[model samples]
Target: MSSILRRIFKGKDQQHQIVIIGLDSAGKTTIVNRLLRSEFIPTTRTLGVNYRTVKYRQIMFSLIDLGGQEIYRNLLWQPSLEKADAIVFVLDSADLRISEASKAFWESIQQNENAPVLFIANKIDLPGARTFDTIVQDLDLTRATRSSRPVGLFRISAKTGENFYDAFDWLADVVVGSESVFKCKLRTVILIDLDSHKIWTTKFSSLKNEILDEFNRSISETMHELMKEPAGMEVIIASDLQLVVVKNHPLVVGLIIGYSDSVVRSKLIAERLMNTASSSIEIGEFSSDVLTKLLKRQWPLDIYKSKPRSD
Candidate 1:
């Protein structure tokens, strides 16, 4: 097995492996760079696979950005397949010749009995790009239904950062929920279920207690009138350091806290969260609730929540 595969399969740490594959010039590298928030001019080809680590909502991911050249297609199986928690297949919406390559990559991922896959039709900003409906029909993904089938199909513009977060968030959800099926090492991560309004975190000493206390305090402060309602709380200890809490109907005005090695990085993320909240003035009711929860829990709560005492 390659070193990349070995580390993913044999490592003692909990890290979700996601592979990004598609046809050449399908904007795979562009999407990867956009996700990483880095700027490097496009190169000819990516040898083997390039990897990067990204943290979203306290979930750490090892994203493997694979080359999409025809010569490298055969190298995608075996070692790479052994440890993937999810697969993202990108397609060039404007290039018919390369669309076949995207389908082939999807087929390889389907052969793997691991987690589900996400299909992304990239380069939507291009004029000749195929419509999402056409791509879905041509890929036959709309009719595709397996217990572990592709969870979603997205049309995106990597250059414009459109629909990127939606794709990444979907992958993160699948990775956190797929139990020992992929032989993945459990790590210190948190899973926030928007539908159920719950949060699941890897148990870590006093971390769970600290988080819960903060959450409770914030909810009480933000939704004082709503507290009389029977709020649901489900706590599960998967291991010594993992705690999963399902809090029903999370309050909209609660706090969001995030931890990172550097204070500067945390501050930057906080600023972004503030901007998002400010710009979402007209979002729908459901979206507003979800956004409020994400902002309150995933960003730096210490900087945002400052309300009067609730005596």
Candidate 2:
């Protein structure tokens, strides 16, 4: 099916809304950029909220990027809360003061009582950032546990694109079928589902051969083969395996591999892939468990079900 026809038939029933709120410069924009694998430069603070649509699996999401500054913080309540399927609160782990702010934000968000919240301790790459345990304790979030509404806390570095996928995968599970709230349009992009036995790329085109050849020579022969044929011309290498591609854009593809091999093997592959493509390559890591869930299209409801917030 053509991307256009798929949309025409699927209609708006296939979308959902996810809101990302945090203090100013808490790496909210960085998280979005990492997800899109593109840069979103913000010269000034977010005036109200910025919206972007991302497609994961066969589902599409209308992601609302809300400003975290004090002046704009109040705008995130009520009306916005009414439509949110999930909320991601990004925090600056390097700043102790931000921990207190995160507590306050959580308290405020708790009052809404409708949407689930994911606490993202962002900027883990900073030198002085507190560890995940420290941030959870400092924010007093351990005491704020709930048994009904699922609250998730993750430590991540948006700058280096670490743990961003884990966080999004959680949100994806929560809002999967409930994503119909988003009525916006989306562009044609392929979503790769990484699996243990094979790599699955979904879209409406025949780019699987291209992706397979690209994956084999640079990475592991263990990578085997591409499972499904490409739906669209777009191919996103989604796997827990490490992918080394020359340049950020898909057009500069060379080799994609896993990061688990011996140091010598990994370095040699990286060097070869880089030299072949002659462009900057990016290495992406995925949690094997998350990749499994993505392939099965199953929600990790167990993770969310354990802790519900108390009144």
lDDT of 2 by residue, 25-86 (tens): 78777777656652334445567788888765344778888877776766665467667787
Highest TM-score scorer: 2
Q: Supply the global lDDT for candidate 2.
A: 0.53
Cα lDDT listed for each candidate: 0.54, 0.53
Q: What is the lDDT of candidate 1?
A: 0.54
TM-score of each: 0.53, 0.56
Regions of candidate 1 where Cα sits further than 4 Å from its true position:
1-13, 38-44, 178-311
lDDT by residue for model 1 (258-285), tens: 3212222322343344344433433532
Q: Go through the candidates in order and give the clash count of each.
A: 11, 18
Query: In candidate 1, how many Å is residue 259 off?
Result: 7.8
How far residue 84's Cα lies from its native spot in candidate 1, in Å, is 0.9
